[model samples]
Target: MKKIALAFLCFLATDSMAQVSQDSTISAKEEIEIIEKDTLFIDMAKYKLTIPNNWKIKAGCTEEQCTANSPQDTLGGFDTYIESINITVNKLSSSSYTAEKYANFSIGYLPKVVKGFKVLEKKRLNSYSYRVTYTGSKNNIEQTWRQYYHVRSSKVYIITFSAQARKYDHYQPIMEPYLASFKFK
Candidate 1:
């Protein structure tokens, strides 16, 4: 019994010592706060797009936003060869914005954008309320893909992912995971 008690006391002392050592390693210079991943992240709410992780969030047209700094304009003979994510939120009382509306906007912009592009696939997440996904092509040769997600309650949340027709296949896998991670509470 005496030996057992001695061993137990030693184990406790060792455990306490280990904890003290760990506590000491956390210096005052280091931030003590835990940095949690942003679950309610929206790069741009109005555009219904998400800001890619690599892309820094810059001041957008609205108070809540960010945009790619590449300054890409499809009108400049630039083929629509890009991938993008978008998100937006609206009030429950507001008019419903469907995935088709966004697709129409893309169609409208495509004329101003790359000259020959048509939508390919457009999907809406029924579980996510107003979420939508769209894939299209440029001149039937270059394919593009887009995804949109929205929430309807007090406010609507929209999230979109887009890529050029040619690059859609390549970027699909990369963006799909991030798209899957989208959730708002």
Candidate 2:
């Protein structure tokens, strides 16, 4: 009786495992369609980004053009509702600056310059990044901003995502992929 019970339990467990594996199988069409993506490569900067087909790239002042001393370049675009997303690469002149110091210096002046300035999160990402999020009012509208500072070779690549406070969550799904796509060459 003990041998029979043990054999039956083993059979049931094997059947359940087989069922789980069968349920997890992916169809060829699903695999191919879901894996297809559109990507953009910036040859001058030696980085590539993946963007959804619906997003449009807008012409605006890039980082290099905006700052006199910093050698920076910016790529920005908008979604279907015209919400803006931007990535700016700023090549700092000093290699002595650490990610923590840079992040602190960047946010230290925010409260003075921005209304309702609040730092939401500040943490390190690997050895070369300091990710930060803050909220403030811009032009009388509450806005949330997320920034990722990638420090490499005396350069800081700042990727910024901003949206009205209420719409911030709505745009997160899109913004997350855009943020993750940033690469330094």
Candidate 3:
């Protein structure tokens, strides 16, 4: 496993005011922009992923399974990341199953494991690939997830992106390239 932190602070926090007064509204002349950004590129044998600089690499992660997590919010919940991506490499026990089958199996079982699981979209490209987007809640926090499944060289690679429901859209751009970088070795 080899990792590189770009160490590029992409944000230019040029804000004149920290908080807007509840009673006051800014005029059209006022423009405030705040950006929090950084990313790390990690290259592994099976895949190469880019993650936010603030995200911590999970202790359980190895060459077989890799996971990176975003920081918890001010509320301080136990759920690992307000947003996260997990990639797992699974070896086939038998040559009978396709990635489609593995993906569907996971989709079917997800609701039982994650509370309030509701699938919003599902796309099957072929017998070899599948993708799904869903929302679920765990530990009192609602979350949205987009998962991808693909098979190559007799191995099924599953990549999952999870985020707080409120932040999913905001975080999607950041997670996109990371998810797309995965492929079976």
Model 3 scores a C-alpha lDDT of 0.64
- Which residue pairs come into collision in candidate 3? none
Q: The CA-based lDDT of model 1 is what?
A: 0.42
Per-candidate Cα lDDT values, in order, are 0.42, 0.57, 0.64
Error of 1 at 24 (Å): 41
- After superposition, the stretches of candidate 2 with alpha carbons farther than 4 Å from their true spots are 1-36, 40-43, 60-81
**Which candidate, 1 or 2, has the higher TM-score?**
2
Candidate 2 structure, TM-score to reference: 0.65
In model 3, the runs with Cα more than 4 Å from the true position are 1-39, 72-81, 125-127
Assess every candidate by TM-score.
0.45, 0.65, 0.68
Candidate 3 lDDT trough over 10 residues, lowest sum: 7-16
- Give residue 53's lDDT in candidate 2 (0 to 100): 31
Report the C-alpha lDDT of model 3 over 113-171, residue by residue, as the tens digit. Answer: 78988988888867777888899887778889998888777778788898888778756
